[model samples]
Target: MTPPPMITDRDRDVIERYADGATLQEIADGINLTRERVRQIVRKHGGADAETSRAARQAAKEAGEQRAQIEFLAEYEAIASNLAHQGFTRAETVSRISVLYPSIDVDVADEALRASNIVFDQNNDTDVFSNVALEAGVWFLLGSELRLKPDYAWAAVNLPQELLDELGTHLSEASVTPDELATVLGIIGAAQNAAMSDPTLTITGARYNELRSELLDAIGLKSATGTKPWPPTRQTLQKRYQGWSDALEAMGLATASLGRPKGLLAFSEDDYANAVIDFISAAAAAGAEPTFAFYGEWVKEQAADGTRRPSPASVRNFYDGWLPALRKANAVVAARSAEANLSVE
Candidate 1:
């Protein structure tokens, strides 16, 4: 500014070197200035030229975003392809989507279809069975649903937009109707709930009962009691118990037994408790007086509290009422089978 600040020879030399393609280090060395100082000077004087650095930085950022988008699309495509192969209905796909992406927009199906790169023929039925695609579709759809849901907004924001578009397209082509999709979704949701409800014990009480019945039938036990004139000794009971135990073991159930002669058979605390109730009911229906003494040792082992074994009288009162009904049902079945055989002859 003061006389336009006399241009020093050193500055002129530095400028000349720079103009000749000398690097900032070379110019700094020539001017005896730090590289940083040289760069600052270059930038200050460069004016419009400084925009090159900013533009480069912006380009790098955009490239990163693009790469992310590409990756997301690839992943989504893979997942959609898998679900489509698995024969998952559209409703199942949507349900999986809702589960994975709760914040997904209601209109995602249309949007995804529009954005998908996958091509399908008009004749390509969505109902066409595909095990692999169905499985993969469920997972991708889950992700898509998560993307639109508010709760998954953060995930949606992080996901590349291209992926979202691709997923939308893939989902749109699914043949499964919305209602069918909902049922599948409900099933998946129920399974998840069941898993969460008891991570350690997945079998339900009803399932246990069915398994128990199957095991009993396998061991030739018409009922828990030996009333069918089958062997009733301790060894016979043990053999039957062992058979049931083996079967349950195969099914991964932990089993145990109690009782001496005509004693009560106990499973685990949970299983045994329920079995006892069932036994009492069965006894009442069978016209047999249920006796606690019949299961005295077993009950005592289960109680472990040293309470006196329940009296035979007490057992009879508890179970005597139900035996008659069961006996009648048994007689009816036997007679029907006999008549059927006679008719066949």
Candidate 2:
């Protein structure tokens, strides 16, 4: 037979806390017991385990969601029927419902209505619904007070009149695409961030690439889904404008340097140079010469040890060419060696 659990005061405290809705971890933290020990004490005292409590909560949440969705559906059907009786098309009904009840998930309503097998008047008002929803969405997102104002946040409270008018024109049309909206917002965001510090700042293709992440973060365009669209990629921008240079020209920005763009910009030119010089030094210590072929493997090794090294391409771009990079790294290595020898002397 198993020995009964010791009925200590701490055990009683754990049981009482668990009964009062304190989680095992919480009880354990208060009475200085391991979570597992607290869990055992609670179970021995006829209380539910953490897993059981979690499952119950999850089940309740799912049931509540189902109930709410059912209620929404019932209301949606009644309103939709009333609208149809008034000779409104399904699209018009959807648009009116979206405007009147901004809290409702219009897409969910649309899907539920479409699945209900109810036929209504047919018209080209689908685009009418699309236009209304798109216009609302653009303003809701861009005008949201909750949007983050990172270092690169735009100083202007509102977009330029020309861009605003262009967006308005797009929404006024019978058709609109998320891609079109994304492109407009992307260009405007990029230009604003570029001019944040200097109004006359020029955004060349390379500079644009360097600031891409910061621009996207400032504009809150991190992830894209099927219904949601993100800022256009570099390839998309280039394709849209016929070439990188043409794109920069369209934006009225110019490149100051002809050198290829470096990665991440978090790493400086010296950071890249130092990485190559360090590699050359380590290779010499191992009786080898650092070459382009071995640099990639060396980077991988550094990564394995949790040290980040700049990409080989970034290093080459920083120094202009492979030979020039080697010569610079060798020169640095020689200077360091000479300094070390002088110190020793």
Candidate 3:
């Protein structure tokens, strides 16, 4: 039998490639050797550092994929942004991209569209970009300094056909993100609801903050500490609108007062009594003491139900003292329990 070829630098190269995940045939084709000859060389090297070579090869593959993704995003941004500015929806833009670039997958096109920041209605098939732009105009006119202009103010409230035509043409071109559109619209809704019960066309910044918190509670969006909320923060709104007053104006509302009204003024005497009774009853059910501290924490928790409970201080103020309030609440709870037991018997 003929002996295998003696180990050479070329053969060493073959061994290295094999260790780096090249097949025997692939190494042979590169080095002008037979597949069997390359395999013998790799075997003689005892597959030294093969695992390390494999890990390095995987790292290289990942790096290549990341590079590809970066290129894809850059290209997609150019195409999608232009389409969005021209009034194309995400679905429309994505469809066009898939046809224009047959190599790109539809899913890849969808991902690129989302990252492009080209606003599209994620909630429905509706044209969110156009809708938001038009709605924003209404609020913008309502809030803008232009509202002081006689012609514009009449148009702002009346929204006549000519005003609608102008707003539709102008505002439909504004660039706005989905989150911003949702938040501004949500604030508008909350303001309208608040206005129904009050005799004011404007609300305080403090009241606005409270209403927003209640909005989040009603919508089931959790607000984490140090993180942005669904409707975003007041600071974010200010940045977007150029100022808090401007933002309120854009929501078609004005600033009524500067600070929060003290003592949960929205609640009445019966509401306060009912809240105390509920707290003591809940504590009794859980076999826990209805301490003032616990009641404060409980009130915070109850906010999730969209019921604005009094602060611990407000509760004290309402009853004239903490211990006296607790005693009264406890008595009410006890009497209710007794009545329930009698009814059951």
TM-score of each: 0.22, 0.23, 0.33
Give each model's whole-structure lDDT: 0.39, 0.54, 0.54
Clashing pairs in 3: 143-249
1-345 per-residue lDDT for model 3 (tens digits): 967657778767777777677766777888788978776777776664556666767887777666665677777787776554333556877888888888876765675566554444232322222333333333432332122222333333323344344433332334334444443444333333333233235544444445445544454443222122333334345445566665554443435434233354777866877888888778889887566677888898899878788888888766644544655565566688899999999
TM-score of 3: 0.33
The worst-scoring run of ten residues by lDDT in candidate 1 lies at 224-233
Q: After superposition, how far is residue 175 of candidate 2 from its true place, in Å?
A: 63
The CA-based lDDT of model 2 is what? 0.54
Off by over 4 Å in 3: 1-6, 28-37, 46-50, 82-92, 101-345
Return the lDDT, model 3, position 74: 79
The C-alpha local distance difference test score for the whole of candidate 1 amounts to: 0.39
Tens-digit lDDT string for candidate 1 (173-292): 443344443333343233322222222322332333343334233533232111211111112222333543432222222335221232343323234334355445555676543333
Q: What is the per-residue lDDT of model 2 for residues 1-345, given as tens digits with 9 covering 90 to 100? A: 988777888777777666555677877888787989887778787777666666665776667666666776787788886554343556777889989999987766776666554444445323222322322222233323224232222312323345445454543342445554544454445443433223234434443333443444465433311112222233344444456554443333333434344454868767777888778777778876466657778988999999999887777555644444665666676788899999999
| Clash count of each predicted structure | 52, 0, 1
Instruction: In model 1, state the lDDT of residue 11.
Output: 65
- Model 3: ten consecutive residues of lowest lDDT: 141-150
